[model samples]
Every structure is written in C-alpha cells, then in structure tokens.
Target chain A: AQSVTQLDSHVSVSEGTPVLLRCNYSSSYSPSLFWYVQHPNKGLQLLLKYTSAATLVKGINGFEAEFKKSETSFHLTKPSAHMSDAAEYFCVVSALNYGGATNKLIFGTGTLLAVQP
Target chain B: EPEVTQTPSHQVTQMGQEVILRCVPISNHLYFYWYRQILGQKVEFLVSFYNNEISEKSEIFDDQFSVERPDGSNFTLKIRSTKLEDSAMYFCASRGQFFQETQYFGPGTRLLVL
Candidate 1:
C-alpha cells in the first residue's frame, strides 16, 4: 500500500517571504510525484510532476519541489509569497504497480497555504 | 490547451433519487476517471474507464454506481439511489497514453443531497 502524508495542515507566510509545504510518501516501487493547487470552487491545477527524470522539479507560478529519495519526501517551495498563491495544495503519489494501469492517484490530506500581505 | 469539462456546476437532489454527472474528456484522451471529495476530506477515487468499459474501480464504487460512454465524446457517472452521505464534489479527469502522464481535472460538480 502506498500513501502520502502532508506534515502541515496550514502554512502562513508573509508577502515577499519564502514558503514551504512538507510532504512525505511511502511506496514499494519507484513513484511518480505531483503537486496540485485548488482554489475555492475551482478545479485542481497541476503545478509540477516528478517522473524520475530529475530530482529538482520546477512548476508553474514560480513554485518548485525537490524529490528526496532518502527522506521519502517531496516538499514544495517558493521564494516569495503572493496573495494569489493562497490555496489548498495537495501532494500526490502514483506507483506503476497499480494493477498494470496508471490513472490512479493517491492523494495526501492537503495543506492550506495562506499568504499574508 | 485541451482540458476536461463537466456539466451542472451544482446539483441538488432528494434521497433515493438518481443523478447522472456528465463529462467531456479531452478529444484524444483514452482514459477517463471519476473522483469525489467530501467536505474536509481527502479526494477518493471512484472508478476508471477505458475503451468504453470500466477498467478499474475502487471499493467505494459498488453496484449502485455505473459508468457509460454514451457517445464518442461524453462519459457519464450514474448513481442509482442517492443517500445523504453521497453529497460531495465530484471531479472528472482524463489522461492520454503517455507513460506516467498527468491527468487533467474538470472544474467539478458539487452534489448536494437533501
């Protein structure tokens, strides 16, 4: 069984300050990791994904995350916070062993990002 | 860029009444999926469809749930008998055949069972 854990339920950061959202995963095989953002009453948008090609992955809206195999963590980060960045962030993990199919995504509970102006 | 689209931004129905949620996946996508998120809960997978048939389904998807690709472009999820607990925001997603491809999600339909 594979699962993702987001350490923080809520994170607050001041404008122009750095932001971080922590996530960890447990998988038996190599995993595909993803970060998605959802605004109120809106659909989820993929910020970035890691398919084993690179450890440091950059995403939209000046966001990025590092996949650390040793730590079993994929934490999202941003250099500066913006009001628009306030939203719910989800960390997802997908393994290739999903009965030979790949559309399944195991999601974390979610972390709410609050940007203060 | 192509994306998935779902109809009925919000639907309110009585218990025991049937409801059908509709979605139009990306034109060239081959896989379709349905997921739901209860208030203040993690998103849970319901089912996955391919080649006009169900390829996979989660434990939550039982006899009461069914999926169909009525036309070439439309995919639908039908709940035979709705319950108060069935109220949630349902999301439709689609993915192409690329290895480890990302799934695109629709705006989602909020179903309120009264």
Candidate 2:
C-alpha cells in the first residue's frame, strides 16, 4: 500500500515571500507523486506530478516540486507567494496494484496555505 | 481544453433517502473515478470505472453505493440509503488511457444528509 504525510497542517507566508510545503511518502514499489491545490469552495487542480521522468517538476502558477527518492520526499515550492495562492494543498501517491488491477491513489491530510498581504 | 462537469452543486436529503450525483466526464477520456471528502478530512477514493465496469473500489464503497454510466456522456453515483455520515463533497474525475496522465476533476457536489 502507498501512503502520504504532509508535514504541516497550516503555513502562513507574506505576499512576495517564498513558500514551501513539505510532504513525504511511503510506497513499496515505484510510485507516481502529485501535488494538487484547491481554492476556497473549488475543486482540486493539479499542480504537478513526478512519474519518474524528472526529479524537479515545474507546474502551473509558478509552482514546482522536487521528487527526492532517497529522502522519500516531494516538496512543493514557489519563488514568491501571492494572495491568490492561499488555499489547501494535498500530496498524493499512486501505486499500481500487485494483482495487476488499476492503480490506487492515497492523499495526504492537506496543508492550508495562508498568504498575508 | 476539455473538463469534467458535475451537477447539483449542493444537495440536501433526509436520512434513508436515495440520492444520485451526476457527472459528465471529458468526452474522450476512458477512465472515471469518484472521490469524497468530509469536512476537515482527507479525500477518500470511492470507485474507479473503466470499460463500462468497475475496475477498482475502496472499502468506503460498500453495498449502499453504486455507479453507472447510463450513457456515453454521463456517469452517476447512487446512494441507496444516505446516512448523516455520508454528507461530504463528492468529486468526479476522468483521465485518458495514456500512462501517468493527470486526472481532471469536476467542481463536485456537496451532499448534505439530514
């Protein structure tokens, strides 16, 4: 089974400051990792994903994440935080079933990002 | 770009009543999924549908829940008897058959069971 843990439940950053959200995962096999962001009352939107293609993945809205295999971490980062970036972020892990069925996704509890203007 | 769409942004139902949440996935996507998130809780997977049948499901998808693709365009999640615990925001997602493709999500339906 695959699981994810977000190190922070809430993170506050001032506008124009750098932002960092930590996440870690546990998977027996090779895994696919993703970062998703949800605005207030809105559905989840994919930020980026690491499918073993690249260690550093750049996503929309000037966000990026680096998949570090040795540390089992996939942390999201942004050079500058914007007030509009205030939202909840989730780290997800996906692993193919040993039985050859479809893959299953495990989500982290979520981290709430608050940007102060 | 194509996107997934869901119906009834919010719904309220009495206990034991049956409710159906509807979604229209991206036209060309071949995989569909349903996930739910309780207030202040992590999102949980309910089921995955492909090739007109359920390909995978989580323990949360019990006997009370069923999924149907009544037409080529619409996918539905039916709760046989809704309980108060069933209240949550249900999301529908779809993705193409390609490897490691991102799943596109719908706006979601907030089901409130009274």
Cα lDDT, model 2, residue B70: 98
- Predicted candidate 2 versus true structure: per-residue lDDT over B25-110, tens digit per residue: 99999889999999999999999998999988999999999999998999999999999999999999998887588888999999
Residue A76, candidate 2: alpha-carbon lDDT: 98
- Candidate 1 per-residue lDDT over residues A1-117, each given as its tens digit: 789999999999999999999999998887899999999889999999999999999999999999999999999999999999999999998755445475588889999999998
Question: What lDDT tens digits, residue by residue, belong to model 2 across residues A1-117?
Answer: 789999999999999999999999998877899999999999999999999988999999999999998999999999999999999999999768555445656789999999999
Q: Where is model 2 more than 4 Å wrong at Cα?
A: none
TM-score of chain A of each: 0.96, 0.96
**Error at A27, model 2, angstroms:** 0.9
